[model samples]
Target: MRDRGPLFGETVLFTGTPKSPEVFNLVKQYGGTPISLPLIQVAEIEEADDERKMNECSHFDWLIFTSQSAVEAFRAKMLRFGFSADLIHSKIAAVGTKTAAALEKIGFNVSFIPTVFSADTFVKQFQPETNRQLNVLFLRGNLAGSLIKEELPFHVVEWTVYKTEKQLSSIGKILNILDEATSVNILFASPSAVHIFAEAIAASRGWEGFTICAIGHVTEQALIEAGAPRVDVKPETYTLIDLVNALARRKEGL
Candidate 1:
């Protein structure tokens, strides 16, 4: 990395899973002190018809994945049931680069990614190549919104591959940071995490000197609703790596 990078003197408090060391490494790569305090946890949902759905994968024209967690959960389920990617004939659509990368790693090709990485933009930009009616399957978590199914112009079916749960065990440490740190950069990746943080930390600590960073418009809106006076850093691209780069740029005032 660059010596004394843009984020040289910053302390970044990550609110996502610590299982993703890449994100924490990114902060350190940019010369920032990274702190891991997961605000949410993701777990696979064991549905009764999971085997049947896996068997019928080829029936859908498109498979949509909104988060990397969904991709990982799907991959795990596929492995547990001895299913292979060869069984899938449908084109894949991912909401973000990381999700697409995860799908690619699992031997599937991503056919579409929205200009912006949010579902609202995805619905507006995604369209079928032919006039024929298309069948789509969205693999998502329990907390995923209904915007995709409600807005897509095609026949859409949803499969809950995962569930996002609040992780408030680290609230004490988060409170300690807020109380002791002179200044901190708090990064939020999802709306669910924002809500948890709002309840556990923000309700008491408030947003005083913390530099609130959001991954995308959705999370940014959540932060705004959670009483973040202003979002200090938000990348045009909505990904964790881009979020770190944006934070570095902000530190350097570029």
Candidate 2:
């Protein structure tokens, strides 16, 4: 049976490589056509200096993972370095449900998760008992914010688990798709994606006709800072479903 719904006539393009099937399917379930154009390719650093960072994992009081990518990258590095899961004696905290689940899958029970998912929320929810001083090790990508360190009173150690680089070939394909698109609703998931997308567009001339939809405030600011016109901004939830649903709601209003 043919379904007629809110997104029945809408076509959407998704950027970034989807790490999960749930998110991938969510895009299709909504009546919109889905296009996957990964603008960034994540690569693990295997240098001796980078490996030394993982050796110091046992020194922290808490190991915080901000994204599933971080968790995966950290795990792979740990295995490569001959470090066992037991090396992670510090209590683990994850920034979001997906990250928490990733940690759990590898037998590390997450000790804390913020009610809201953001660097600010994560730092706010962190409480240090009077008897205990905390030294937190944050695992993230190269483009991650330093806001967590700025906001926290505890001693913080940051490790860049993975590095994201612009995939120029993918960007070229994205540009081609944008050129052929009638009305492109470009969704930005992170501030990094926003920056990378802007850089890609600028390098490819410009996305003058496409409507830009940022996933959150940070991304909105990034878009504006990059000289792109803003079309919409999603809330703090930062889920693909939320963005898709919000897009559907806007279409209904129109």
Candidate 3:
């Protein structure tokens, strides 16, 4: 007989792409069944003029990346335009550990990460070395808000490098999971995914009969506003590794 893991028999569904394959494997290591139901799709916005505008990236004093999606889009554009990391001399600020890791993976050193992994906090905590008027470029998706650009005292420029759209195809798969599994854990990584789930599934069926786990406060608030009965789990730190560890601890009653 095999030893039972902490998450024995628990069905874990990911509403967003797992940061890495390790996240999915972690659930299985704990004896849980991992399922993927990405509720949002992100793709780079390929504008013909962007090839010219991308040159502006080298002029900014600071380059900000708020999400892994933004990093991915920026990377794709850089590769498309034949731009190298050495060409962009701007200091990089990443909002979360994952974003920073993604930036670092591409040979760019990250200069800043806020005390918390939230944009609201990033706006409050990020300060450059000098008080001079600095040019900051924020690379983001279409669904992103203007909080950083509006709140930052620096001269900010926004480049919409990516767009996020609802992944409707996952709706049927999620419903199928609900039908087959007696109890399942649904992990929400972004508020966008939460909103999609609310509109497509929760609106018709209601937010019940599943364990809800949110990655950050923003995502949790989205679930609250969507009228979920409750959010069953959330990590203290807004990272996928922490979120999964938190779920395991919850299952272990720690």
- Over 42-137, each residue of candidate 3 has an lDDT whose tens digit, in order, gives 888999889887898888999999999999988898899899888989999999988999999998999999978999999999988795899999
Name model 1 segments beyond 4 Å from true. 1-3
Model 2 residue 253 lDDT score: 65
- For candidate 1, what is the lDDT? 0.89
**Residue 254 error, candidate 2, Å:** 2.2
RMSD each, Å: 1.7, 2.7, 1.7
Give the whole-model CA lDDT for all candidates, comma-separated: 0.89, 0.74, 0.90
Model 2: per-residue Cα lDDT over 109-197, one tens digit each: 89898876777778888785657668889887998888987888888888887898776677777787777866567777777776778
Ranking by lDDT: 3, 1, 2
lDDT (10s digit) by residue, model 1, range 1-254 = 34688777778998987546787898887888999888999999988888988988889999999899999899989998998788789999999888888899999999999989999999999986887999999998999999999999899999999999988787898888877886689999899989999998888778877899999999999999888898998999998888988888888775
Best by lDDT: 3
Candidate 3 segments whose C-alpha is farther than 4 A from its true place: none
Model 2 CA deviation exceeding 4 Å by range: 1-3, 49-55, 82-87, 202-208
The predicted structure with the larger TM-score, 2 or 3, is 3
Worst 10-residue lDDT window, candidate 1: 1-10
